[model samples]
Target: MGIKSFLASRKNQNKITTHMPLKVSDYMSTKLITFKTDDKIETVIDSLIKYRISGGPVVNSKHELIGIISEGDCIKQLSDSRYHNLPMTNNTVEACMIKNVETIDGNMNIFDAANKFLESKRRRFPIVENGKLVGQISQKDILKAALALKGHDWK
Candidate 1:
């Protein structure tokens, strides 16, 4: 009888756990540099520069996400102030924040989140649970998740 290949049989049995798609929560940033509506735009600018972040979520005292503020918004505020020759001192985050915020569910698949980013043209999306801001996910976070699972099947 021909010698059977033990390696071939082992290979058939070696395929282990079925790879599940990664979720947004698996790589979202929980400890975020969030801002509030009452926060000064100058303060927001300072936080953004200090943290090296382009934007952040605007929340309430109860941690409820109400808006999003970005670098572009701050620039617009600055430009408006310059155009009208007015000082941008008392400007609050609500003056420039995008109030109709779009949030993402934590249970969403990582790939799906990528698609949402593309569709919305947003850099980051905040995750809320029971109306409370829990975390935020970004394009970089999804990329990190992909790199972490580089060798594994993305199914």
Candidate 2:
């Protein structure tokens, strides 16, 4: 068969699938274990262990994203408390979480989100809408999305 005819024969035997470009919201985890500013450090630690999560977002009663608390931050708190001879249990999430939180746009492309994670060296980025905590996207989420698109002709 000629080149054009040969290519048409193969194309007729296989199906092509197209997908809308992936977005962060499509893969982000909406059900999150969030912490409050006034919550005790002990409680945060227990939750992190129970949920098998390294960190959680700190929000106000109004659910506004405020800060983020991580295992590293918790460990740092323990070290600081020991060095200062201060009691750690009495500390609050507000005392240890990372303030000036950076959130990601839910509509951002999944690949772009992956780049953002690499650039910022952040494991996860929270999504906010109308000043409320909506969801969170993680490195693992992006990896999963990439795997899901393995056979698709998309970037």
Candidate 3:
């Protein structure tokens, strides 16, 4: 290959791997809104609605994440209540939360984490470090980070 072409090709390869090292901490939302496992589902719903969020992490008394509760999960209870005349107000978050959750390490690069998001049905992922919930990253966060890269390689 010509010297100029080889150098241009190498630069393009560097561009791909350069952003691969960008950490999730750089884009994750550290000011996370969360819920407690024992918190009443009604309260959970209220907080979610108030914050205009679809869901949040469910933590325990020691502030350790246990699960995630979302509006989609609540819909089942609401539907049961309407069909069977059962009360939904008495439920706890633990009863409706998704106990099996996928979490990401806070230090994971944005590119890798974005791939995880793309492969899963989840809209958001909890960022954990040392088994403690540190922050949250959503699809929007990845999009925002990607958009920030647009002007970087511009002429």
Best by lDDT: 1
Model 3: runs farther than 4 Å from truth?
Answer: 1-21
- Over 10-109, each residue of candidate 3 has an lDDT whose tens digit, in order, gives 8888865345326888899988888887788788879888999999998877668899999988887788778988677658888899999889887888
lDDT per residue for candidate 2 within 39-143, as digits (tens), equals 888898899999999999998889999999999988888899999997876588988999988999999999999999999999999999999999999999999
Q: List the candidate numbers ranked by TM-score, top first.
A: 1, 2, 3
The lDDT for every candidate, in the order shown, is 0.92, 0.91, 0.84
lDDT of 2 at 53: 97
- Backbone clash pairs for candidate 3 read none
Off by over 4 Å in 1: 1-12, 18-21
Candidate 3 Cα lDDT to native: 0.84
Error of 2 at 78 (Å): 0.6
Worst 10-residue lDDT window for candidate 2 reads 12-21
